[model samples]
Target: MIQLPYPRLNVIFEALRYEALPQQELAQRCDISTRTIRTDISALNDILASYGAQIQHQRGKGYHFDIYDETRFLDIEKQTKKMKSSPRNAKDRMVYLMMRLLSQEEECKLDDLANQWFVSRTSLQADMGEIREQLEQYNLELISKAHCGLRLFGEEQAIRACIAHILFQFKPSDHTFIDVCEYFFPEINQPSLKTDLLELINKNHIKLTDEGLHHLVVYCGVALHRLKQNACIHHVDQPNLSEEAQKTAAELSQTIESLLGAPLPQAEIDYLSIQIAARRVTGVPEIDTQKPTEQLELTQYLLDYVNTHYNYDLRNDEQLKRDLLCHITTMILRVKYQITIPNPLFDHIKRYYPLAYDMTVAAISHWGKHLIPDGEIGYLVMHIGVGLERNFSLEEQLPPKALLVCDSGTSIVRLLESQLIRSLPQLTIEKVESLRDYEELSKVDADFVISTEKVSQKNKPTITVSPIPTSFQLEQVNKLILMNRSHPYMLDKFFDHRYFSVLDEPMTQGEVLKKFSAHFTEDNITPIEFYDSVIERESITSTILGEGIAIPHSLGLLANETKVYTIISPHGVDWGNGKIAHVIFLFAINKDDYEEAMSLYDLFVTFMNGKAVDTILGCHSYDEFQYVAKECWFNRKKDW
Candidate 1:
């Protein structure tokens, strides 16, 4: 039941003194026209929609009101009694109660509800009329179906968001401290934290509670984040620390060990100390603070970015401010290495919230005044396990300087240099110096001295393997270079080759030739080339293996054990004849076959087809390649 505060509405409502009968019966009993009663029914339904209720008509029965109220507005009056109450307080209060009842049942006996509210049924009906009007604006619907319960269903997350809205309205800003603390440290005032903290604090000389420790950490994270924002990654120094800076470090160290149960790494400790010092110095606002001025413009840009760039929708309301803050926090902590998120959480964020992470990167670079480029960049992690296995190809970065030392003068050095430069693309020969100038070697800033006859330049790293270091050296050296600080985690990313195969994934030239010799021949021997002439012939084109496969191999593979590899593609790849299915190999057998075997690659493709070829390609690992060669390549099938 609702109070009909207005006198006119009250009089009209009470006028329905004899309203016990159904619509037709009531019209006859009250001596009103049935058409007039119908008019009343329609106007009454409209009023109920204003109150956030819908009136539905059953086939054989009279119409009933279905109120839509997911907000559970029953407590609106209690919430609104505070000083911040809105002018439309009365209506919102009515909406709240209606919402609660709507959650219960689609239709209840009007007499029963009116009795609970201590008002007449007519008064309750008048209130339903008010709810019906505002239903559309709120994106709600009121349906009256046969015998089913009423539900306020639209978006469940949106419905729950009303709780956040209520907190915004009546709850004081002081509660934001509670909210932030709960987010960062959910266990602070929580029963478990409180109990555990109390037990620990009792052992200390001074009294401390869970809330105290939580607020300290929360403030520390905020302060530390601010510190990192100011300290430039490559240039931060320790001379600019204040007294309070020193205190936060000591406290953080103790808390990390005592409270968090994890000892702080020395590197993290130094970084945090620097940030704490930086936060005390006042300087430019972080990247996002200084802006292009228009408030609405910035908001709209954020909205568009959120909607289009990300998979999830961002809140368009004032709450977008909070989302922006979260983005900033995540970016600053991650980019500066101030915090290391758990590995699994990192994977989840990377997978599901890619745009969030992207936004985070932009926010960090923009605010922190860093030049980290933002885009779809990929990282490579390179490593090699065996002496004979070539793990990587180089030619990406300008190679380190090298001094090629052969006993001969410039002619011998130039010939060896030409051989290396042609085949080993990454190695850059700085100079070809004579053996007598070994004392002058100290002057050359070369990374390595590559030589046959060893000269003494102990300061420079030397790789002493003929004119050619093995292919494994090339792979290992490149991987080693990637591990240095200049590459920034490059060696931590694409280091996995176990999942790739010649039959499965397309590969470089060297993998194919090495693979075929390792399998097709009984000796499992691959030719190794020491000069440039052997490699130049095969670099011209591909060798198609046939039947939906192509192995574009290099004569470089037959040169050594490390150059041996297998590459396969089942999609019937192209060579120059419009298409090429497969290539068995490009073999290098000493200096003679290495140059002459370019003709052998074209001859192998004409005879293979179907399962006969696939069985050759299906070998899982290196050892199994021998089995595939014996069974499929030789037309004899056997398994162990």
Candidate 2:
């Protein structure tokens, strides 16, 4: 039998067992990237082919398993279960060892552990080295007693964090803490605990995601179990709580005590307060009038930084101020206690709100004293990004203009122009006339021309459509209009010969960034602050845009003019996010050149989204790069 290598194969198969799963859904359910999931489906189909079955991926519908031979497919599923009985690889061994250490109270003998994996003691010892390194990251230790063998030793909260990490890594997204604990340690599992917890939260008016609720259950379960074993937590820093929050925490502590048949110490109660404070709990308890001076100072610093740098005034935005205060208050507690919360929207926030992310990075660097993590920075991005977006929306935006050209008469042209105006409310119709009149015009004043006749204009976007447009044609027109409305700036204008480099030598992302930064500074194209900003932005999230391309740029314009520095690595540079890029586009823009910067960026995205990425990377010289850019972009289907 060809056993599946993936431990999460069942997660995919079970999802596709009933209905088709969209690529996004599969990605979320598996907690893996969609790119990885797409690749896995292809691999899965190869395996299923032997069983006379295949996984069909329809763009709109998603992946569905089509099994020709039910018995063979069933056999494959059964084989997956048998493979699960024994750890197959290092990753599996690590997870299994962690589970063993966490679920059991007593020390694990090397002999028993070796027997469990059918490995010699020497082999198990080697594996334990890696396990020790992994545990250290969570501030947990693998301790060996003279007579008792090995056991995990850490603060109760840290150990629980390890358990939560393992649970999240191996299971489907929907599995609750109860589900995981029941599977691994049925003796301590409480099925009704989730329901009781929900009731208590509802009664206290505490708001948390289902995932957060599950997390609380695991924390409570582990604390209860450890308390029973007399392994209670100690010296936990007391979290600052509002009067309302304090009341809720007190009620929650009382409820947990009654449910677990265990008594809690003051330190344990405080730890629970920390958990509540760190999470997105609703109905915050009342607090003292005065705020923490340090947090208030930090908030004022953030508001001032935005006003000074970005020219946005948020000093009087009470809601924004209050949100920042709450976040910083909880953040201080988290930093002290080593608590972590995952931001699911981190990537989206970074991608869409580049400016806000930049501002947040600067503020954190200046105020944080080098202590905050990337995850926490993400939360700040949302707040600042939203504030900036709101301010931007208040400003007037110029609508896209379209010059309609038709070979038909005025009567037909008039009707067509009216229809186009009705269909595309966002577009400004500059003129509706014959192609002859358009040619007679010395210059095209509009962004893009919509015509029944084909016009060759390398500079502007053109859409060849029916005089009376169809739905498909309208979609094409809409895409072009939006593209034209976005900055039509090109990177070639800013592409300096001295700034560009073709590196045949193997280089890492950091090395590439360092080389590019030095060139920019030496040439006086930008100051060191620009390069520092670029590196800082990268530290928050990677600049990889997929398809073997990365565009690493700083947050704010740090140059006199927008400039792009190109680096071609025949051997791909790892750009984090499990992506390797052969072409690295590192650039910096001036604050005044933001529009041009956005245009160049949109064009780059267009190139990545099309078949041009491969061709661009294949270019041997700067001339070839320009040639490919013009040919690929202008010649691209006028649909966008």
Candidate 3:
């Protein structure tokens, strides 16, 4: 019997249980493309044919399993269950290999690992390259001896941190504390261990968040495992912990040492204190006297930076101020001591809160002091995201005001006003005037203008509707109301025909960026150093938002003037890692106009939907692109 690949295991199980599953459903479950699912199904049928079973696909339904000889199929299933349970994907294999090396007392041999996993030594060696790259981020390394083999060489604290991060990667959000302990450290008495730790933590009055408590427990368990192998931290830097944190660490150490039946070194105790200090939530003391001056100043600086750069005046938000004061207290320690805390919601936050994440990144980059890791950045983004949401909610609560300009009789105007009020309850009609009166006014003091006649107003948005508005016309009015709430006027000012291009030929990301950069440089819009900074930013993280869309920009505000260079590639450009970019928006933002950055980022996000990207790609001229983009933006206003 052939050993089943890990990716195919789920497909086979679903086939055996259900009569059929749709191709899209299977692809979603496995987190692969429909094309890849089709390929995997073919391979599975080939393997099953030899065992008197095959997978068949229906036109409307999906894949189904058929077995001719029950005995043969049963044998194959048993063989699959008994096969060696090694990791089958590169990511899992690398993680397993790193854990093995970290836990081993002696050097590990590639040959031994290859044989254990049933892979070639060459493949194992290739994975080692990736492992080394990942370890570099944690300040850990792998050293090879001439004859013995390879062993992990790094600070004991760093090794423990790396181990905690690996374990966190495998922890599901719904997992209980004991469930995690059982999976990572099966030999320990998890129930008793957890009870003891909680008792000590409560006894000492050491406050911790739910995630913080989980991290502390996992770290203690990891320390115990390492100590059993005689691998203990001999030296560590002194951490600036509070009196409460120090006492908690002392008691926690005693509990861990009792479980190990040994005394922990003072260095280990100090390291544990640092971990406790980093995770403990400091209470917001009386703001007038107990808060540290330095922390207050830093928090004020961050708030001011956001206000000046992102146009978010959160300086008066007392709740946001207190939350920042509390979070930054521990965050400073984590940065100073190089502590690594895994954020489980990092991916979700980045996906849904791109504007907040970018603003946070820009703010931190402007701080220009310590190098903050992405994990810490994720936490800061959460605080800023809440502030943004609060501002949006307050804006939404205020009913929008509109001026009615109708060229009908007084009775007709009254009827139209009544109809509008019934349809749009949230709208406040500030004034009702005739067309001649509206045209005679020097300025319109309303959010938008609703007219029954063809009227032109450049200052405020104008929408024309029938004397009695239809459903579609009301929808247009509603969309206009939503758009006015956000005031996303940056689209018209930044995107211009002069800066747009349609590239029919294929190009690399580097080639396209450099070409755009050079053009801007010649036009005196950006310095020559702009291209390098953009490349450095891309190296940090790919700008590809997936689905043939990419928004590449510099590390900081590098352009002399703000402009968006739009590119439409009929033939897709390579954006690294098998991603292609059909619609690229290379952002050239200036510091003076940084307040508009959020709106600009939102515009790119609007194009991230597959349909919007396809519509943009179909346009051949700048005028056509502009019209299609505006339609897409208007249609997606509800998402804002």
Candidate 4:
């Protein structure tokens, strides 16, 4: 396996994720000089060639990765992933240095560190300054000794938390050790530490996030090293721990003591309990698990808000409630200690799970205020989002069924039903009867009604086909089956020509939002309160999804009726957070029309995921916008 410097490897990996990028664009995104990027690419290719992968350069399109043998390429990826080595970039290096400092029991001299990294002492000092700033976030500081080196000094709890937070940020392979001490100093690595930790977790039936589990294991290893040097955690006002967590912590301490062949102190046990309590798993809360009055009240408030606005029956979801309570409990401790956990998946979460992300933003605004940042909100989104996904999955698996109506004999009807079943594995034949049997029936009770004769049952969808359906008939049936599986009707009514507008000039997000919303207010299409809610929602988090599309919608139903307003800017406008959005969707829905709002949102997401955005960007007229949307919706692939 080959290793590139910290950020250089990271930058190359990022560049490989895209199709192609211009040299200037690549350099700007990586925050490096073009010459440095070129040199790095050359060096990276030399390493990649060994794994049957090469970074290819186009004349003017920048660099892209070409893999000649996927198996070999993946092998290298796996090896590199297991190593989890530090990137050579400045930010990663600072994090690496901090991890090294946190894991050490003694001061590390500046010259020694510089010599180890083959860097000048002055350069190392600059990195230390950055590390100092990061430590200050946790209320920790770097103390320099006259004849000695620098050492980190702070509250014992804060130092432990800093170590946990730093280790948690890096994702290690399943079989690999997540211990920083192991990464920096292999001789100090305890191979049995992870094995013993897992055994303790399993014996006590402890469950935690993968990252949480890794952090706890690494923290325990470092704590053991420090405690051996007589650096024990002092007493502090501790947060309450659950009975189950207390037991788990005791078992963990016993396991560690056994592994090290030493008797653990009471202070170590208490510290372990504190760490365990801070990351209690997401499960049914124990009967005696205590919750702070204010946080519990806020949890109820948020649940009610979600229920009232989205009409989701989440109140009965014990897992969601328990998860939220545990998360908030941990959050309070993090806030009090000024401990920040950086979420590496923030961008991906914001982009892929906008609705969940939006709901999280609302919750943060209502409860967190200065306490929660975007990173924490992202984790909250994952918890709530999983519940919502489960709900949708249940809806999709209700079974696709079809009603068969033919003026033929019973044998022919059975043959048609069998052929239909054979063609569509997911489809179930609900009814097989003659035309007379069909006419006597009051209604159709299936996903789609397949009749030889043309029968229209108002809102019910019916397809006409021969007794022995042709290939084209099967295609139509397939399309109808897909249509039936889509969300509740009212998609077409959501978007209207009356609400669509083409801007004469590019405007800021605020200007576009205000201008489009005022039209609704003036026409009595929406209430005055609606405008305020939309703007407030935008302020909570920018709705920009990049690639020139922004969806701004209020959480509550303040509009007089459900409506979607499309405002297009030929030149993209700044939608905050360095995003320039050309397409803006102003969605206003009534309280009872939540279903329609969600359906419209799904369509918009699909549209943005396809080539429709390109067509939309090329459009000069409102008619073109509508046409592009129509084409995209019909051709869009089902991702959800």
Candidate 5:
């Protein structure tokens, strides 16, 4: 029998499941390219020949699984089920090795593991190197003795935390508790344990987010596994807990004891209590007397930092303050204890809310007290993103007003008014007047005029349309409204021909930054410290927003004058982590213009969409750049 790779097997499964699938659809389902799918199908046909089956492809309809011998096909199908159960790649092998080592106290020999997994010892050792790097972040070490092989050496609590982190590391977004538990804890009854834990949490009025609940349940499973091995956390400092928290801890310990059929030690119980407190959602008011002064002060400092640096005055938002207070209080605990709580929506949050994410990163980096992980940063971004949304709503300016002139009767005027309102809600029609009345008016109070007849308005811009406006007319109105907005002014204000450059040579990120910084400093646009600040900001988090685009700015407003240096790297700069930036926008913002510069982020967000960066990269001069940018902006008017 021919052994098919995992991706090829997935393609086969999808083809068999569907009657007929398009090549594009199959590629998307398998997360591969259409070219790869075609190659796989060709290879699969050869392999399936021995099994009395083949994958038939049509021109438009993609691929279909045809079987001539049911017995042979069934044999291969049964083998695929077994193949799916084992580790398929290096990442999966590393996970399997981590779980095996963490679950047992005995030393694991690389040669033995290599034989068991049908791999070379060299390959297993390379995987062990990566595993060691990951474990170091959790304060755990992998120690190897000459004769005894390799063993994991860490505190019992840290070990268990590592176990929980590993289990949730690559968890799918749609994976259930049972799916995760059954894979990681095959010997334990996870369904029963989950039921007992859920009931106990409800009975005790314990507040945990769905994510928090999942974390607690998985921690309990790890605890049970360690306790069964007679390896327990001992001699740890008892955390300071409130009276209510102590009672809840006692109840939780009892529930665990009943499930384990053994009494937990005081140290283990204290550790468990700390976990619960870390994960628990507090219901205390924002101004509760028990609220820690340090956390409140830190939260206030964060808000002030964003307001001063980013020109977003969220300091006065009471709800934002409350949310930040609650989240930061627990976040500090998680950071202090090195606990890992995965943020499942971190990617989505970062992608959709780049400005908010960048603001959160900058604010936290300015705080400079703790080395907060990306997961915690993601949670902070959510809070700050909502606060920004609230601020935008409250301070949003009114739409452009337009006057309507129709030659028809009252019925036609009414119909045009309704149609215009439905199509362009952002546009306000001040009044409706006939062409003669519009001509007779001395002064028009509206910004623009929309008319059904071809009439000229000297004061305001006039747009001619049918009584019933077509889609093109509506689009023209929308484009006009968007142009009247801050987008065009923003483009002209920051981007300039003097500051734009096209680099055809290959360079590193540092070289590009240094070159841009030198030019700015020599021109007296920015201070010498600007380069260091930009480097510091990048060190905290790379400003790359993906899709061959990067918006690099300093830690604070360090420029003498606000300007944006645009660089188009045709050969691509080697950004760290294997990312390449084909278009770079280095912002040098001054403190005086910081308030008006807030709209700059929106312009960058617009360019981050589909093919906008590519279109901008293709520009050879400032004129071309400006044209392509305005085109991109006009196309994405609805996003604003």
Candidate 6:
């Protein structure tokens, strides 16, 4: 049933889009003769018509097409819907598309499919054979009876099994799904799927390679969860689960319980675990309740954090509350997942956090940090982080050691500055440009600048900040630089935490010392000593940020990075009896930069949101990754 990939369709579509072209012209553009152009145009137009759009002839123009761009999309949707019934098509594409939909929807009609595909019933029936073969790779079945036409059958559970195949394709290169899934599926820590998928590849005698299987695992999890709730509601005779799968799920449940400290209902653990494993092992996709639960938790956390930490209660307005929660969720998912930024997602974030958008982009480029949130939330950080982290100083020198530069946001930034200074002796203060003078700043000679969002460039080191950055973001920025709170990358514009709660590790004292000597400063305390000093932090709190990333350093000094050294262990270090792939250890050089460290710490927090560390690990070379650290440090410099 395997068919050669049809590159021709894309070419045909492109060729037909021309206003009108001579046979010779089309041949040049499409590398096809006038004869081929005519053939493909006919094929494209036939399909286009079913979708409510037509590829009309251009007046006197050869190879030209008349099309309604907006309406043409309807054709796409219709074709897409048709494929949903069963992966049956005149061409192989419709067959593949349809099969996926049919598998999801559990039904389709041959006559409708035939009409939509612009093919005779006989020709389409022939094509359905090809579709069946293709589905067989993932154990997909195309069950066709004389009356039934053609439909997808077999275990729906395998949907996740198939989906995990292309999860990375839907993801941006910077974020890795495996890492984020690390948090969601704590039960499968070693990523045993790597082995399982490999075995499946060999057994299926299918085309997808190990790499393909690797991604499919997560994509399947996501898709299965997405569909399990509603898409699969209509299906009959779904697949069954094996006991081996159940046992595995229970083990996973135990793991998550260990990580969360409090045990989730064992029944919930059992159900979710089975669901996750079923989607992987069985040919049927299992349902996922993780996203909904996670979102609910995040909203609650936001409300709590904002009220207690930021002194603002956004819950007063139900609409704003919902909107903001949705906004943040999408942002975190996009960045965490490292998925492309959808236009609407960007528009929404820009609509709500416009000033932070451009700044966040600038910060990423400057820091050489790559952030791919599904929307403009990543952009928002650029707006604020860049304003806060600065290379130079401002006029204000106060405690908690950061300055405020918001234009008209109720002095929240100032209040934050004051509150932070109380705990930190290194705290300093500075003037918001709106309230102070150039001369005054020169007199004070502030070490950094902090602003609510991007406005203009400053002569000194600065950290642009969001009035209320997420707690995760705060943790990352705070740990990167200790100066004030500046995300210097943004005018310079926009920018970007901590695992104070790291799990226990059993590293040898000597091993710890070597980590220090090779990477740490010559200061009296060695890395091993620091590890020992903070080892208690692990027991008290868990520091495993999602994405196979962990950060462990002296509790009091973890956020300060006056002097710096970093390590990237792709293999992941053992923490809390769990394996972590990317762990960042930081030490600050100056006593003064400590207050500025919050933003640096917050950077990690921001990244931990979804799939940050995994994306970081995907980087192939040192040159590709160093800027993230540079951006973090510069962005973390405080404003005061």
The Cα local distance difference test for each model comes to 0.39, 0.71, 0.77, 0.71, 0.78, 0.44
TM-score, one value per model? 0.21, 0.75, 0.77, 0.63, 0.78, 0.25
What's the lDDT of the predicted structure labeled candidate 3? 0.77
- State the RMSD for candidate 4: 9.3
lDDT of 6 by residue, 254-275 (tens): 5444544554454443444334
In every candidate, how many clashes are there? 42, 6, 0, 5, 0, 144
Deviation in Å, model 4, residue 125 alpha carbon:
11
Q: Tell me the spans in candidate 1 whose CA falls farther than 4 Å from its real position.
A: 1-159, 162-400, 408-412, 434-444, 453-461, 468-640
The RMSD (Cα, Å) of candidate 2 is: 6.0
Clashing pairs in 4: 5-88, 6-87, 6-88, 7-88, 7-89
Total clashing pairs in model 6: 144
RMSD for all candidates, in order, please: 30.2, 6.0, 5.8, 9.3, 6.6, 21.6
Looking at model 4, residue 379 earns an lDDT score of 80
The window of 10 residues in a row where model 6 has the poorest summed lDDT is: 491-500
- Looking at model 5, the pairs that clash are none
lDDT of 2: 0.71
Best by lDDT: 5
Best by TM-score: 5
Which runs of model 5 end up more than 4 angstroms from their true locations?
Answer: 1-80, 120-122, 170-184, 258-261, 286-292, 392-480, 638-640
Clashing pairs in 2: 207-282, 243-286, 244-285, 244-286, 245-285, 557-589
lDDT string, candidate 1, 159-184, tens digits: 22222222222222333334433433
Cα lDDT tens digits, model 5, 286-337, are: 4553655767877888888888777789988888888988888888877877
What's the CA error at residue 457 for candidate 3, in Å? 13
Lowest lDDT sum, 10 consecutive residues, model 2, at 170-179
Candidate 5 local lDDT, residue 413? 92
Which parts of model 3 have CA positions greater than 4 angstroms off? Answer: 1-85, 172-186, 287-297, 307-318, 366-369, 388-490, 521-548, 555-561, 569-582, 590-597, 609-611, 637-640
Q: Model 4, which residues run further than 4 Å from truth?
A: 1-86, 97-137, 140-154, 174-187, 202-211, 224-232, 242-244, 247-268, 280-299, 316-353, 368-492, 496-535, 546-548, 567-582, 637-640
